[model samples]
Target: MTPALPRFPHGPGSRYTARAAFSRTRPNRQVRNINLAPLVQRLTERDQWLAWMLHEHRVLTTQQIARLTFPSIRTAQRRLRILYEYALLDSFRPLVQSGSSPEHYTLGPAGAAFLAAQAGCDTAELGWRPSHTGRIAYSPALGHDLGTNELLTLLAARARTTPAQLPLWLSERSCVRRWGDLVRPDAYAHWCDDGWREMPFFLEYDTGSENVARVEAKLASYAAFTAATGTRPALLFHTRTASREAALRRRLAEPARNLDLHVATASADFTTDTPWGPWWLPLHTPTRRLPLAELASRWPELSPAYRPQASDDADSALGLPVPPLPPSDQASRP
Candidate 1:
């Protein structure tokens, strides 16, 4: 008998989900039908919040989770192991050329059910299926996704130690839902210091994988957005290295100049420097690297831009991209 091909859900044939069908090489099991109601009751607010994050971002590494939510790496590992055994989360470790990769986590069946039950919605409405973790385990964008999450997680980590706050952070899906036709940013975020002085911006995390010209061309959409909305939000680029940053600045300068787009850039040192420090170099002031706080000061007009939540939009204002930071004890309570 001719063998039948396995099917996939959520229409993952798109490039975002490069591997269309189920991975024949799933490294971890997504256990199902566990008696998790009691376990869910015992789950901490942070644990619930972590599951919510996985549902939103698709995946996160142990290091990223520890930095974002837990006080210590050991502590994170201990709790994460418990969650995995309870089927509240599923995880996988991708093969690497050198050292082993950190365990990456995604919402498991129990976690999805818990979230759906909490929200009074069906599991299908939560946008998850039995094949969810299988698909992510082999995704080509795994590294890129991790990089994007790491950057924002770092910001959230810094926010914890400082007086700054990450009030609003949106994933690429949320960005698309909000501004798909006009622009496609990898992520969207706003950073605020002690005074609550804020700057909202779109992030384009570059891996030096595509043409510089192609990256530059995205400016046109931002220009179109400004034309349509009569509001301009800052567009920031974070690339892998100094050379890539230089190439982008050169190609982007003229279009940005011609279109009057608000663009700033930071390079590899982004991870080392206090992200709030003077690492960002706005195109207008190329010679001077300004602190993020000072940069916000430079553009006094760069305030939070209101988004149009069309009735057709699926996300409730409170859902999808919750706050960049974890939900508080009060907010996480059922």
Candidate 2:
């Protein structure tokens, strides 16, 4: 008799074998030729806005861009493909062990030139040095930056549906320009709603990579910022784990003398729900997670200097409907 065939424990159809087979046979699409002139001519104001955002933020994934700029994911993907093909945006896929990572995009040379002309400045002045951007694209801090951006992108998406508007999203670079000596927040945001006026905030995104002592040191800097400006914006710390949140809270509880500041901490998992919802646990009151709107109530002592101005032009620029303002103190929270 012929030698018995080697025994197969789970036959030849195990899940692992099937996955390997599928991976080997997976289809890869070829890049399609695109007409440059027509694509450039078809670019709309919104498209330009997207490019400007990329230039400012350095890099954003397709999902983040979709949430921030487009009405729907499908529309975003279609438009992004066109933009990519026409060389208005450059993208790269990071190496991952499992499923592919979302393509992260940066402003292309042509797009940068267009923005430079629009701003009446040179590309270097607009911070569009290709080499520098490329370096940033692959930097180790990229994940931290992306995490910070995702928080803002979620707010932008909410603005499209709710009666809220994120009128201003200042990048870290912009923050440095404004207050580099005092502190550099991951990002600064101004939120406005029917009830709430422009409420400015400083976002500190923590990925649990830094030591707790370092985080506390940063808090000291924010405290210094509050003392100088006399306008203490809420410091929102988005940490990577519950343990990190606990550790941060402990450090926050024992702040330096004469350093009274408002701070809130939340884990990264909270992003699964509405980012502006009751996700933030204020250090002053660690028992409950308060919504973004209610954060002001937690710090009644803070007299914010930044005020939201009434402007039809601003509303139009954001493409949001102007809601009737309720009769309430512009500076006071109800």
Candidate 3:
């Protein structure tokens, strides 16, 4: 027979400690404390946008959401905690050995219901089921998806401070829905600055988990897409390492030789620098690193799509002011 474990003696005033211990032991049950009604009432349009983005992208880390939506990490943490408590958001921290991983968030049930009500449709019609969202949060591709969003988050943050223009951003889901059959870029963006005229590009964010040959094969699809559409958008490949970049460049040399497409490569090592800075090197000229704005000069024959028209109503929906175009001379530079 095993000896009984000794129980610590509790003083007469230790009832509060016992209750606190019970609460700690049953944290998952704390959802009962959330008041959903008032929480919904407290949500603003910006908050709603955060929910929509979560629904669209599936998952976003605390830092990514902070960069995309909030002015600071502290503010994001406080607000996200309230949202999480009220069931408007759900979060999980991936296991790491040393430092704690940042909390990653997905849309919670209450947020789905709120969005459905706003759309005048059933929650099912909003393409949101909490179970499904939860599963995706734990997917193997979670890191890749977050990395792709990180690129856009960086762009959004830059737009807040710099004169660089990110006129349009389309997520992978949006791309697949729109062009699923042809080629689905990880993300699509348009960059225009005083130095670089206008560049509409397809972003392929590689985590180095994929085979290099498989990655290089994507150029053929992009080439076929250009042929069909008669419009060739520059292809920007952001890889995780210099070795992968070299391999991709070698694989791309022959296939891209005769295609009308323009390819540029950049490594994730330069993420701390301005994403639009001189981090990108053309596949044809690997030695030269060009800022995004100066890339257009290299391909004079390729005509970029016109910038998408944005109205006052659209600007209001985006929650950002559209920067005025630079002077004609500055914008018209080669």
Candidate 4:
């Protein structure tokens, strides 16, 4: 919904090679026409939402789409196959070393056309190019993008069954528009349980490729952000391993304490522990890990610095990204 993750919660994984292959485009795909009425009439609300979501994220694995929007993986696959058939989506499965990866999807020509028409703007304004999917397939950052989206999509999945909701999730692009000068959070978000407490945090999804000093150095900007905004949102570091987490925690403890910043550390295993469990190790209490919701309580004054512009039940007139999950009206459908 917002610009694609400049960086989001993720870790390193398989790299797509120049020699890699992708799922072939369906031979019977429909051609785009100047008139989009027929195309618009044919799509379900879910289908249209998925297309916008793809445009926002640039690409999404089948598993991510399923968890973020559908009732089940089976239903997601069935519906996505139809979208591909009509050229509403374009997909490719990476040629991995062992077992195959879930197919990855990017916004297709028809989808791009539909969204542009809806916004009453040009596709170029949407930042889409004819070679969108092709570029994504060959980019070195493919693994990192998928990994970052994976973290939030998993959180979206868990929130699906519970009362919790993600009120605002700003992509790296949106983060830059708002906080670029002061901080470099890969993404910024507000997680809340309906009518209760909200936890706003700057997400730093690490791949463990940098030196500890490089990681520690980023804290200075976070310190600057706090001083400027008069709001103290938590800064979370999601890295790749226990060892990486340990090294970061040790190095960050002093700087974080000195700045009086609230920093927490976790790793790849967090997805397995389901993010809500006791996986987060705050720099202040490195010895004990606590659940995520508990972190909100640590700062009784925790409120998002800026409220999201979109209402819970309606789209923005100026086109803000929709909720991370689909509309509640579509939540129960197959």
lDDT of each: 0.74, 0.66, 0.68, 0.74
What is the clash tally of candidate 2? 0
Q: Write the per-residue lDDT of candidate 4 for residues 24-64, one digit (tens) a residue.
A: 55664333453567776789877887887787777788889
Give the per-residue Cα lDDT of candidate 2 at 223: 82
Looking at model 1, residue 117 earns an lDDT score of 77
Best by TM-score: 4
User: Candidate 2, 121: how far from true, in Å?
Assistant: 1.9
Q: Give the winner by TM-score: 1 or 3.
A: 1
Error of 1 at 148 (Å): 0.8
Query: Where does the lowest 10-residue lDDT sum fall in candidate 1?
Result: 10-19
Sort by lDDT, top down from the best: 1, 4, 3, 2
Query: After TM-score superposition, what is the CA distance of residue 62 in candidate 4 from its true location, in Å?
Result: 1.0
Candidate 3 lDDT score relative to the true structure: 0.68
Residue 96, model 3: lDDT of 42
Candidate 4: regions farther than 4 A off: 1-21, 27-35, 193-196, 310-319, 329-334
Q: List candidate 1 segments past 4 Å from native.
A: 1-36, 306-320, 328-334
- Decoy 3 TM-score against native: 0.78
Candidate 3 positional error at 156, Å: 1.1
Q: Per-residue lDDT of 228-283 in model 3, one digit per residue for the tens? A: 77777788999877887888888887778777569988887765547778888888
Q: Give the TM-score of candidate 2.
A: 0.77
